[model samples]
Target chain A: MTPRIAIQEESFDLAAETARLTAGRQDVGGLASFVGLCRADDGLAAMVLEHYPGMTERAIARIAGDATGRWPLLGLTVIHRVGRLEPGAPIVLVLTASAHRAAALESCAFLIDWLKTGAPFWKREEFEGGAERWVEAKAADDAAAARWTPA
Target chain B: MRVLYFAWVRQRVGMAEEEISPPPEVRDVAGLVDWLSGRSDGHAAAFANRKTIRAAVNQDFAGPDHPVAAGDEVAFFPPVTGG
Candidate 1:
């Protein structure tokens, strides 16, 4: 069976991941996937992602578990890359499969939203002149995650 | 206890991890932060803005009031910005 969560320095193949999740699975009628890329905004040359090793995996698994609890998902996958990445490289991926489109699509969206704020990964940007700075968390990302919380 | 730092917090703190024994009065995350702030200028600078600093006790997200004891693994970091 394909692993549901992966945190690695190497990149991933979306097509292969999708096939592995749905291959020979007739019950899955909908599969939604989201891929996040590193943008070369401003004079950016590269981006470095740092994470708390053991905590990163545990935190992601917890979030993935929450998604499964909230939706009738047949399968789910979350891949996040760490270390140094060039502009345009893929940073993260979220795939959700279910019997219907609604569950798969909504769960996929929910996973990414929660991952943005809940995961223990940090991003540092390297500019063209060799200057580097850590990326600041956005309040909007927190708000996005908050929308799912019970009032 | 073992304390770890990440991202900008790590950068400002000048090291990734450290071993420290806090005084008994340091019973919680906020108290620990106050004690750690006196260790050095780097730590004080890293935690200058309390709102920007986040913490984890034994790898789980923790708040200021979270109690911390000896032999625990505590981590200090900035708000995460990952997708």
Candidate 2:
């Protein structure tokens, strides 16, 4: 079992990825997966994603690094796509494995949470009336990441 | 002196990329933004509410004070919306 973290520009095939991770892992009793999909804004027609080439990997590596340190996860995977993407595309994928389901679930959540707040990436939405800008950080996503912060 | 805006910054600034040699003192992201806001009405309007503005140096997440050298690619945008 290994920790795999990827920030890719190309789309990922979930089925193929799942099969490869689960194969020959009889000792693992739990598998956790989180797939993020595009959401429809009130009237936004198109969405584009932008990120830093070198920083994208570094940001993800830091988040994955945190999860590995805090959890007993035997395996983990994180893959996200950049550039223009349509609705229903998988923006990010996280998979975790452990002897118990709790660690798998928690670590998966941790990865996504940290990625949302800690990573540096942004989006633009094109609407018929005009383009809507996203200047402020998402409060909800920031809250989600804060839930795991040390008290 | 290429100033490439990314994501939300590009949309709000109304320019995807530009090139300019900002004055001395305005040598970093923070200084650059201060200088940009005085250039034109559009710039002032775009960066008017800078509370939402965030910047990076050469593709790395950085604070407003991050030093930027000539030929370095500085990107300004909002907090990330990536999944």
Candidate 3:
């Protein structure tokens, strides 16, 4: 199984990524994907994402590995962009492939939920008029992740 | 040990990375944070609200009581807001 993880400042091509994962693979029957976009808020100019160099990739890979362990996935791809980004820009992408849709869908959700809380990236909102503030963690995200915890 | 800060924690602490050698009694993440807080006003400000801070020892999520030792790459940052 091919599991691709990338962190870069450049934008990613979703089609190319999906093609790379599925190329020459006939066992894949279901593919689930999620793309996270930067939101435009009132007076928001840009959002800057900061991350720890070695830890970010490690954390995401660990989460992806956990997903693979829990589900019968054929392929997994996770890409996260850093640096300054304007509203509506893509910030992250998660794609999961499996022989069945149920496994693909559940693993996709699991990967994203873990990524939200476990990944070590921080977002700083840059607003117009020169004001800036760090984005705070949402309890809702924690709750979302908690639901996946084994009882 | 190498200590790293990220996001607003970096801004508050005023640097990205540094080297420190804590005393032998500084055995865990919380102890390291408390020891680091005394280094300067910037550290104190960065560590002021412990609730907002998170830690990783050797790139793994570590809790307050997580044991740490010399030569570990300890990182401190605010709670993750990534997707």
Candidate 4:
């Protein structure tokens, strides 16, 4: 089955999204998920996501394509939300279905790793007391992606 | 020249996009920024810090030295904060 790659600004329902990803697939043995939520403690009271119209879609699709090619994955879905969002909301959702748990788990992790480092979307966060700032690239994200490189 | 602003940049500039001709003295990204900063109070405030803004020329990421020509599309926005 073809995978789904979307970058949107709307809020998403997790249960509904899971059902859609596993539809019509009896051969699916394992499903792995990774959800990223906006947090209040992290000073991210609100987030504004900005992305290039064409480049955002192409970059996300390429990552999903690469994930599918690297594993024996039968189905996958990627959902990323843009625009303004409140705290504790899901920012991204990645699902993978495969013949075994290891592949599904690995692909799920890989998807997030690649997304953090490769995707072209940018975020501006609002903090308490009316402060705001653009987030810088984290060194941790780079280190996570580096582990997946072939020796 | 068409100057496009996105996201917070749009909010600060109080404009989505606009078409204009660069001043004779405005030659590159940096010079164009200086010119835009003089447009209005909001423009000045948005361009105030200077360090927070970034520019893209013709959909490609560009630096301050990037050249600007007549009829070129220039986009300005804040530094990328995505993941």
- Best-performing candidate as measured by DockQ: 3
Two-chain DockQ for model 3? 0.92
Candidate 4 per-residue C-alpha lDDT over B1-83 given as tens digits, one digit per residue, 9 for 90 to 100: 98888766778899989998877778899999999998998888888887878788877667999999888889887755455
Q: iRMSD (Å) of candidate 3?
A: 0.6
- Candidate 3 positional error at B71, Å: 0.9
Q: Give the TM-score comparing model 3 with the true structure, all chains together.
A: 0.97
For candidate 1, give the docking quality class from DockQ.
high
Q: Candidate 1 residues A1-151, lDDT tens each?
A: 2338999999999999999898887999999999999998998999999999999999999988888888989999999999999999999999999999999999899999999999899999999999988899998999999998989
lDDT of 2 by residue, B1-83 (tens): 66766665666678877888877677677888888888777677767877877777776678877888778877776778777
Global Cα lDDT for candidate 4: 0.82
- When 2 and 3 are scored with DockQ, the better candidate is 3
Error of 4 at A41 (Å): 2.7
Better of 1 and 2 by DockQ: 1
Candidate 4 chain A — worst ten consecutive residues by lDDT sum?
Answer: A51-60
lDDT order of candidates, best first? 1, 3, 4, 2
Per-model C-alpha RMSD: 1.2, 3.1, 1.0, 4.2
Q: Write the per-residue lDDT of candidate 4 for residues A62-131, one digit (tens) a residue.
A: 7788888899998788888898888978888888889899999999999988888666677778987799
Question: What are the clashing pairs of model 1?
Answer: none
Q: In model 2 chain A, which range of ten residues has the least summed lDDT?
A: A127-136
- Per-residue CA lDDT of model 3 for A1-151, tens digit only, reads 7589999888888899889878997999999999999989988999999898888888998898899899999999999999999999999999999999999999999999999999999999999999999999999999999999999
For each candidate, give its TM-score against the true structure. 0.97, 0.80, 0.97, 0.71
